[model samples]
Target: MSNYTPTKFATALLLSVLLAACGGNDAPAPETPAAEAAGTAVEPTTAEPALDAVEGEPALADAPGGDPAPADPGAPAAAMPADAAGLVAGRDYEEIPGGKPLEPLNGKIEVVEVFNYVCPACAAFQPLVNSWKARLPADVRFTYVPAAFGPRWDPYVRAYYAAEAMGIAERTHDAVFNALHIERTLKGERGEDSPAEIGAFYAKHGVDAKQFASTMASFAVDSKYNRAKQFIVRSQANSTPTMIVNGKYRIKGTSFENMLENTSAMIARVRAQGSAAE
Candidate 1:
């Protein structure tokens, strides 16, 4: 009886291990869930700041926990969102040292998103971005900066610049996202895509496929590529879908919704600072 008991216990443990092993996967599922597709996750009731803290700053902290910090006394009172008061530095956002706008300010508050086409996170963030940007005031400038972190990511950066060169970037942006994340046509993730193949996708949007492919490696596209790399390096943005506000603050929100809210608050902060200077 004692010997049987030991064997039964060992068998039970083996069965549990087998079940866990069968459930695990080294590869991504063929399809992402709808919530993840939208890039939304069930956030905790008590939110904490992200660990992507600023460089040279103390290690990422869980401070200012439970609720956001109160509104900055220096933030402009007018044109600010109600939640702006809850913004806490190092948690909601971080100041970039010696940061400069990727483009000339030209009297506009610049907000740039450093993203990658192969990034599932960026794909999920797109819908939210579309909605948020639509509500932006005329004085605010929103820019999309595609990240070329490696060979797999670089082709899409080229594709973006090439499309922009042909004046088809805005028109084809959503289509590109759909092709990659929703339709699963482009092989950006597998690093199996080429300029010609990607150009073929853009061709459906009225671009000449051959010209599009050629432009991917054009001198102009190369220039944009180099500048983007430099700007990302200097900003210390190591993740896709990172939001930089007025080239001064890098947002690190607790969730997708929180990110947009923080961006709005930062915008107000910049506007207020501008007014004070005047």
Candidate 2:
């Protein structure tokens, strides 16, 4: 019998509530057609839709070995689908002022997804992100930036950089999520897991447990983790699963599917602009 209990469920629910609170508030419903027919004058209101999380940058270290390398600037851009056209700014997405990527573009369109392992929403979004990432064109580079929203979340941020530095991040990414949310082997926000425990979890993946724990607190990991936090601050992102495209556009959508569609379109747009500049 599984030992999973409401504590995990409650933790996720609480974090979700926090995510909703920090991100944009739910937009007020527009006047319904029935209300209009009733001759009630409804004032127009403008508000941004709620994002997944919002809490709110620098050249990040090179991605772990598993990520696809950035595409050549001269490489052809992917075809822009019809659905990508006419996306409303501030409605479908928001433009970041003086935005920049976490890493030097070096001619590739960059996409950074801000996430935290403790974020229930991010865990839910991972499978979708993976599928979308697999289809990306050669000119696009996707990176994951973990957020340490609080003390409880900070260790995982350290762990992520440590794992990345060790080149085990790619293989261990999903497993970490599963361990916390599915397998219940690792406590997330409910009860903190020590560095040694986390390292032990990665041991199953073939890394030296003690070395992994040491790396979690190493200077390299510290630098990378801080850089990620800086980039998140620069991007003005406060939520999990937030996607920034080329550091120019912050993707927003009514739903996850919409977010992905907007991201694909934005990638195409950036690629087209780059092609034009040449």
Best by lDDT: 2
- The candidate 1 region of ten consecutive residues with least summed lDDT is 42-51
Point out where model 2 deviates above 4 Å: 1-84, 275-278
Work out the TM-score per prediction.
0.72, 0.70
Query: How far is 62's C-alpha from truth in model 1 (Å)?
Result: 20
Q: Mind giving the per-residue lDDT tens digits that candidate 1 earns over 1-278? A: 01223234324323432342354534332223334333355321111113333344333333375777799999876643334356777777878888778888888989999887666556656767888999999999899888775566789998998998999988777667666654568866544788889888998889799999999999999999877776776676766678998777898766677888888988898887783122
lDDT, residue 69, candidate 2: 84
lDDT by residue for model 2 (1-278), tens: 23333345434533543443454534311112222212123211111123223244323233378868888999886653343365678766788877778888887889899888876566656766877899998888899998877666789999999999999899888778767756668877657789999999999998999999999999999999878877776777766678998777899876566788888888887776673122
User: Candidate 2, which ten residues in sequence have the lowest lDDT sum?
Assistant: 28-37
The segments of candidate 1 whose C-alpha lies over 4 angstroms from its true place after superposition are: 1-85, 275-278
Rate residue 31 of model 1 by lDDT: 28
**Top candidate (TM-score):** 1
lDDT of each: 0.69, 0.70
Clashes of 1: 1
